[model samples]
Target: MKTATKINTRLVVFAKAPQAGKAKTRLIPALGAAGAATLARHMLGRTLDIALSAAVGPVELCMSPTPDDAAWLGIAIDSAVQLSDQGQGDLGQRMACAVQRVTQLEPVLLIGTDCPGLTPALLQQAAEQLGAHDVVMLPASDGGYVLLGLKSPCPEIFSAMPWSTAAVAEISLQRMKALGLRVWVGPMQHDIDEPADLDHLPPELMNL
Candidate 1:
């Protein structure tokens, strides 16, 4: 049997507690509030499982609203991973915080729970790419990115910029270029967010 090879790169997953009305709310129109929440729960669990199974490095679950908040009650996390709160900020701020902190210790891969295509192999590939490139970014079909791998913090890329818009990935790319950083960006992948994105969900999650 092949054994798992541990890499030095750290993997950080930013997620929100699967609370109804808050989690995966964009899908509520198609799946209903309770159903959307259920899907969110499944996504978070599967994302964590994939991250751990990758064995690329130590895994961290960075929670929004913090784990102590009532929103996280009854959620069971794997003991193999570390937990931290994505303290105060908008999306860009929260992500930058985690990236800056972890990259300070070691190379890191920053991801979220919304992408079904974030398989173990993809993560390992990203980590490998980081060996030669200063950064690796996997862009989302929605124009944002699903994963970002970095050996060090790039505050300019995350500060005072528009987020959630179609320009996110492009702007970040430009920032990296201006900084003279070597970057490797993968082809676009689907991020299951809005109701229209429901079509992109994996076969197993379709029933949900």
Candidate 2:
């Protein structure tokens, strides 16, 4: 199927509203529920800032609980950000839904508010990659991916599969290969999902 001609890279940043006990639950063990939520809020803001600064295309924040939810009350999202609800599903299902929805508008670079290493330069690089390749992804040190850029909706890659295990990235690569999709895997980066991952936090986040 012919994909939409790439316009601006439709950047989608996925975030769970940083509510205590709901966001960053794994880190709650070390930082406590409040502290973990504080950290989550910081990370979400930082990710949005980075995404907007990239200026690669229109920035959309696909928030869970929808933008109208009280869970998002007082969270200062930028005016320039277009908001959308992630609706319902597991990680893979929500992601597949987002990809399917946006790829029709333009090629999308879907990222989560996790990787501090996902810089504007890297996002631009991935945007460029999506122009020529079928798929581009920034691998996470944990077995998953930090960013997924696609020129078309390839749900098979995001379908029923392990979401959190280290095998996630490899399995995705295998799935893409089976479908004969071109894939660009960027350098691996750390995701602050566990307490030990806090050690990888950059200086800006060290204060947490």
Error of 2 at 86 (Å): 0.3
Backbone N/Cα/C clashes per model: 0, 1
The best candidate in terms of lDDT: 2
- C-alpha root-mean-square deviation, each candidate: 3.8, 2.8
**Candidate 1 lDDT over residue span 136-194, tens digit each:** 99999888999998888888888988888889999999999999998888768899899
What would the per-residue lDDT of candidate 2 be over residues 80-127, giving only the tens digit for each residue? Answer: 999999989898899899999998888899999988888988888888
TM-score per candidate, in order?
0.94, 0.95
Model 2 sits at a Cα RMSD from the real structure of 2.8
Model 2 regions more than 4 Å off:
1-7
Worst 10 residues of 1 by lDDT: 1-10
